[model samples]
Target: MRTILITGPGGSGRTTVAAATALRAAGEGTPTLVVGADRTDTLGAALGAATGPEPTRITPNLTAWRPDAAARFREDLTAFQTRAANVLDLLGASRLDAEELTPLPGAEELSLLRAVRDAALSERHELLVVDLPPTPRALDLLALPEELRRYLRRLLPPERQAARALRPVLGRLAGVPMPADWLYETAARWDVELAAVEAVLGDRRTAVRLVAEPGPAGADAVRTARLGLALRGLPTETLIANRVLPEAVPLHGLLAQQRKALAEWTDALPVSPVAHLGHDPRGADDLAALAVPGVNTGHPPVEWPVVDRTAEDGVLVWHVPLPGAIRDDLDLVRRGDEVVITVGGFRRIVALPSALRRCTVAGAALRDGELRLRFAPDPQLWPR
Candidate 1:
């Protein structure tokens, strides 16, 4: 399915933009699903209806949903308790009832992954519109799947599952009860689901649409969002300049500020201006008035291609593009087979390419928003 991930700074009308875009696609006879995980029910307001944990029909071709994170948390915990009942009983641990359970802080954000994976994989919708949290939070949420999967690998180590029969013997030898088989099974299931969600995010057909009111603060937010996403290799296709003033509105105050921001944005990326309707957006009429663009052919997924420079520079260069990155805020550390890239408040651990893995980090620099790392052949590891 083709998907559009919409996000912006708080109060930037990203939810409205997402609703309008999905409505536009549905109006044109495409099957569309718009989902959100925001606690405020913003997507429902934009859709002129209430949404819930279940997908609700907004129109013949459009469906809307706001995943119930608390409910999901309760269900998951209850199921886990059931699976590990013997383990709990053996340890004399008390099982908490579902009624008294409350979701943890990040439950809401992580719930979005399950929602997206289910909707995208079902083949029931042709276009999916995701109303993500404000850009900063959304970027972190986007990174959650990969990060969680990494943790899962470290904790559960799927390879250890092969010795399942030996678990009992090992536990006997250690004179302590080993974790139940259900634990590894649950981790494996979660890993599969998280992988699916990560695939949806990294798919070539998925495009990120950045929404922001054109102003100084919005400009800064947009730049930060762009840099953060680029650092993670998620491509941003367009900037939806939301709540724009009319061109004829004297062009002297807010309009002038907006115009200036738009000019800057236009130079750096494609801009789609959504005129303000002079009120908070609500219902179908308001959404239509926004005139948000429908989904477009998305760009190819970002790649970290290695450039050969062994002849001239005696090293190979690995290029990682991170637009809008500042030199002062960037840091890199090579950790075994992987490199940890820290830019500002964001960080990503990237595995090295096979050829680069055998070489040592000769030098590294951030130039023109691209991070270039030079690798010199290591006599010990590289083929002689």
Candidate 2:
């Protein structure tokens, strides 16, 4: 399935674009699901459909939903609290209520991401179009898989030969209930769910379409979003310049100046396969016009960095290119099953592909600004 995420700074017409894209895809005989990630329920209204958390059919093969993040947050908190209560009870503690399990800060975004993953995996849709929040929040959602995986991996224990050595000693000291086994099992379950999300997000067919207005700030936001996505192996496919003034407008002083500035900014954008649409992008017809080939906004072709994997002499070599980043400014962090790279004042958290998580880091080197990390297969940690 192909997944397209449409996002940009607020007021950039992302919701309209997303709805239009969904309509076009459905017109082409593809089952499309458009999800509104924005807190405002404007996407459905733009499409002239009833707004609700449940999927509303807009076309023969098109459906849209404005998921209630607050409601989902409450439900997720309840479920988590119930599980925590059970686990706490097993350890001879009092049960805790859902009120105590309210999400701290990032929990709401995580829940939204879970909803997106579910839409992607649903057999009812062939294409998933996500109308994400503004650029910053959208980037956070994309980076979540790596962040959660890292935390889970660190909290859980290795279960093979290492467990043989550690469990016996811990079991003897604890006397009755062993917490390591439970922790490992919980971690394993999380691992499965995270892997499913990573698979859907990291697929090449899953592309991010950056929507931006013809202005300096909008251009910068798009650039940052593109760079962040690329660092995480999720590349931006199309740069959509929304709300551009038409050429027919009388060319004079201020009006001409604004048009020239827009033209220059559009040309300067980095990612290629660009397209331009009007400010008043209204219905499916307007969107269909924008999706037409050869809109040509003049951006460079996007080349995604590859993660090269090789197993040699019992060590797995992972060569990650950290171009234009200095070693002194780089921060490498391993949180559970995720690796975070901070370089050149920019940070990107990456979800380790399933194959790499089975290995332990043998050594790491940051030479000439390229961070290369080596890992060795850890048989003890490999799931049987």
Candidate 3:
């Protein structure tokens, strides 16, 4: 299955583009599912159908779904309370009812991400089209699985969980409470779930389609978004310049600026200009007429590998592709088995390959949008 995530600056008509793209794919006889993250019925309006948490057939081969974040939040909290009932009873704590629960700040995004993961893994749909939040929020949402997995590993290392039988004995001997068996079980389950979601995100069949209006703000947003996406090694399929004014419109200056933006985008990725609809697009026919082109999915970037040059320079170079990274904002550090990379405001800690872990960072450089680090093998650590 191919998963295409569509996002852009808010009010850039990304949902409309997403609907049209799914409609086009369905028209070609592909089984396509369009998933939306909006709290309001934006996607339903574009598809001219009512959508909810359940998947609804919008057309012959297209299905649309809007994740009910509030409901999911309630369900999750209620289940959690049930799981911890024993502890709550001992503490005389009252369990909150689901009816009184409301979704917290990031609950909607978490629900949307879970839906995306499930849809991507399901065999029912050949194509999954997701209408993600605007660029900033979407980036954060996409990065969540990896970040959470990292936290889980740090808090409850799997190695420690392996000795579950000794936990009680050790806790009694130390006269302190170790993590309960249920806590370890919960961590293991969460890690598995997060790994599945991360797999979907890092899958070769998944790619991103960026939609933006053709103007200064949109251009700036795209550029900033590109840096973030590149740092994460997310492949961009195309740039959809949505709501482009016609050439003959009274706003000739705006049209000229759009032309310039389109040309610039063409050089970066496939540029597909969606003309201004004058009114919000409604119904399948209108969406189909919009002619939003689909893109071929590209495999995500390969991992940074150690290129040994021991014979010539006694150095190993690790090459990491960061397409839009600014040289001034880049930072690299080697900490034990993990290398911490900071690009702009985003940071990721990636574990080094076994061979690279025995080496020390000698120097680093950002050239041609790729960050290359030179490492020297430690004589004492390298296998004789």
Candidate 4:
């Protein structure tokens, strides 16, 4: 299945675009699912139909879903508390009532990811259109699975789980209590779910579709989003310039600004301009008229591999595609066999390939939206 993640700066009409895209696919006789997260029926309003937590048929072949984050959060937390009941009882703590359980800051993101994972794995839809949050939040939300999985492994290594049978024996010898079996079981379950999400995200059939109004602010947002997405190696399917005014529009000022923005994006990514509909689309007919193109077949997953330059310059270069990375916000450090990279507010520790593990970071530079890190093999560790 192909999944198109749609997002942009807030109020960029991403929801409308997502709705139109899914409708278009459905018209072409493809099974399509449009997923969004809103406290209310924003997606339903766009589709001119009622949508809820469950899949609702919007048209002949398209289904719409607006997952209820608050409800899901409540259910998840309740189950987790039940699983750790013994631990809570030992601490003399009472369980949280469903009414008192408010959704946390990151709950919506997790819920959204879970919805996407479930939809993708179900194989019911040939196309999955997700209307995501604005650029900054969306990028962070998309990166959650990998980052969380990393933390889970570091905190509860799977190898440690193998010593489960010996945990009680070791605990008695050390005069301390080991983590209960439930803890490891919970960790293992979480790991499996997170891995599934990550697998869907890393699939070649998935691509991000950016929807932003044509203007200076939108341009800046796209640039920042591009940088962040590039660092994670997320492939962009299209840069949809939404709400573009017509050339004959009397306002010369806005027209010039939009044209400039369009030109800049055209030079950077795949540009698809969706004209201003003059009013919010009312239903499937209106959405179809908008003609938001059906999803592309999609490209292969983005992978950053170190290119060997030993014969040419005796150095190995790691080419990391960071489309909008600014030099000022970029930082890199080689820590043992992993490189810690901080681009803007996002940071990731990526393990170096075996060949680069014995090398020293000689230099780095950002050019043409790619970060090139030069490495020199350590003499002591280099193969003679």
Candidate 5:
């Protein structure tokens, strides 16, 4: 399934663009599902129909959903409490009621990821359109699956589970009760779900369609979004310049500013300009008028290749492709076998490969949209 993730700066009409894109695909006879991630029903408002937990059929080929994120969070929490009932009973603690529980921060992102995975794996939809949160939040959401998986592995190493029967004996010696089996079981389940979500996001058929009203602020937001997406190895399919003033109209003021911004963006990236609807777009008619493009076959994931320069430079170069990263804003530090790289204001900790683990960072530089880090073999760790 092809997934189109739409996001932009706040108030950029990204939800409208996502709706238009999904509607267009369905009109063309393709089965499509549009999922929205918003605390409010912004997507439903754009569609001019109420959406909820159950899928709402807009057109014969189109379906829309705004999953009940709060409900999902509450269900997970309830299950956790049930699994640890013995522990709570022993400690004389009260269990949280499902009715009183609310989703904490980050629940929406996890919910959105699960919805995407479910829709894609269902094999019922040919295309999936996602109305993602604003640019900053969407980037963080996309990174969550991988980051959470890493944390899960560190906190509950799978190999340690091999000694499950020995846990009681070890606990007795330590004079403290070991964690219950359910804890490890829960962690394992979460890891599997997160991995599935990551696979869907990293699929070649998945791509980001950035929607922004062409202007100075929009330009900066797009630059930041592109840098963040690149760091996470996600490909951007198209930049949708939202609410573009019609070319037929005489250019002046805001219209003139849009032209300049569009020209700059067009010179650099593939851009799709969505004309202004004269008012906030609503219903099928308004969406059809926008005429957004169909889903794009996204670009291949970026590769971090290790180039050998042992003979001449006595170091290996790790080339990381960062299309819009600023040189001066790049910084990195090698910690153990992982490198924490900060580009602009975004940071990601990437674990090194087995070969690179034995090498020490010699130098790093940004050249032609790529960050190159040269690593020399560590005398202590490298085979002598």
Candidate 6:
């Protein structure tokens, strides 16, 4: 399945563009599902279809759904609360009500991501177009997998025998159960779910299209988001510059100033192909016109090469070909849960795969424009 996620700052016409893309795909007889992650009926209304929580057939090959992210948030809250309560009970704490467990600020965003993953995996649609939240929130949603993976790894099991040895003693002294096995099992389940999500997001077929207006601020935001997505290994295919003024606009003082600003912004942007649309693209026809070149024919701008996994010199090695990358401009940093990479004036943040994150980086090398980073098995961090 292929998923195209459209995101930009609010009022940048992301939803409109998303709707149009879906319409064009559907018109071409492609089975397309457009998901309104904004929790608004704007996308459905544009298609001239009645909006509902359930997926509505807007056209012959197009379906729309305004997923109730709030409902999904509540469901996730309930599940987490139940698990927390079980853990507390096992530790011999007083019963706590689910209502008392307040969710963190980003909980809803995480729930929305889970909903998106579920929708994409559904068998109902061949092409999934997501009208994502605004840039900042969208980045957070995309980063949730790495965050959750780290949290689960820590909470499910502690490092060292000292942690395990103290658990029983502490439980006995405090008159609690201290069931470590249950925590491990819970973490294991979460690991499986997160792995599935990571796989989906990491797939090159899943493309993120960033929408922005023709201005300095919009360009800056797009660059940041592009780098963030790359860091997380999410493929960002195209950048859309919406709301460009018509060429026929009369040159007045303010109009001239605006035009000059747009010209400078366009020139200053990173060296990536961008699509420009006149005004906000709303309704089916507007979006159809704004469709990226070759998108309707299933050709994407960025093509990700396949990686080969094999063993070399008694060590497991995976070769990912990143052709055309300059070795001199390449820089890498291993942060807590992410790998920050800078190459040829472009930066990308990459979330480490579970296996790689657990292993220590044995060495790194750049040869023939291919950067190779080796990871050695860390017995201490590996799952039991």
Candidate 4 ranges beyond 4 A from true positions:
none
- Per-residue alpha-carbon lDDT of candidate 2 for residues 1-384, written as tens digits (9 for 90 to 100): 778878889887788778877887788788888888766678866777676788898889989888776667777656655656757676797754555545567766776677778988889888888888888888778877877787776555444425655766777788964554545656677677777888878776687787876666765676567556656666566677666555565645534654554665456444322244534655666667665222122223234232435433666666665534556777888877878778755787666667678888777787643567777777898655
Q: Whole-model Cα lDDT per candidate?
A: 0.90, 0.69, 0.87, 0.89, 0.90, 0.67
Over the stretch 42-128, how does candidate 6's per-residue lDDT look in tens digits? 787666666667888888899888766556666665665576885667668775355455556765566656667787778977888
**Reference-based TM-score, model 1:** 0.96
lDDT of 6: 0.67
Give the per-residue lDDT of model 5 (tens digit) for 1-384.
988889999999999999999999999899999999987888999998988898999889999999889999999999999999999999999999999999899888888899999998988889999999999999999999989999999998988889999999999999999877898999999999998998988888888989999999999999899889889988888899989888677767777788888998998778988889899999999999995876655566667899999999899999998878888898898988899989989999999977899988898889878999999998898777
TM-scores, each model vs. reference = 0.96, 0.72, 0.95, 0.97, 0.94, 0.68
Worst 10 residues of 4 by lDDT: 291-300
Per-model C-alpha RMSD: 1.6, 7.0, 1.8, 1.4, 1.9, 7.2
Order the candidates by lDDT, highest first.
1, 5, 4, 3, 2, 6
Q: Which of candidates 2 and 5 is the stronger one according to lDDT?
A: 5
Candidate of highest TM-score = 4
The whole-model C-alpha lDDT of candidate 2 against the native structure comes to 0.69
94 Cα displacement, candidate 1 (Å): 1.5
| Deviation (Å) of 232 in candidate 6 | 2.2
Off by over 4 Å in 3: 295-305
How far off is residue 121 in model 1, in Å?
0.2
Better of 3 and 4 by TM-score: 4
lDDT of 5 at 231: 92
Model 1 poorest 10 in a row by lDDT: 291-300
lDDT of 3 by residue, 1-384 (tens): 898989999999999999999999998889999999998999999999989989999888999999899999999889888888888897899999988999999899888888888888899989999999999999999889899999998899988978888988999999987887777888898888888888888888888889999888888888888878876768777889999888889887888888888887787777888888889899987897796986454555445567888889989998887877889998887788998999978888888878888888889989977888888999999877
Q: What is the lDDT of residue 369 in candidate 1?
A: 76
What is the Å distance of residue 140 in model 4 from its true position? 1.1
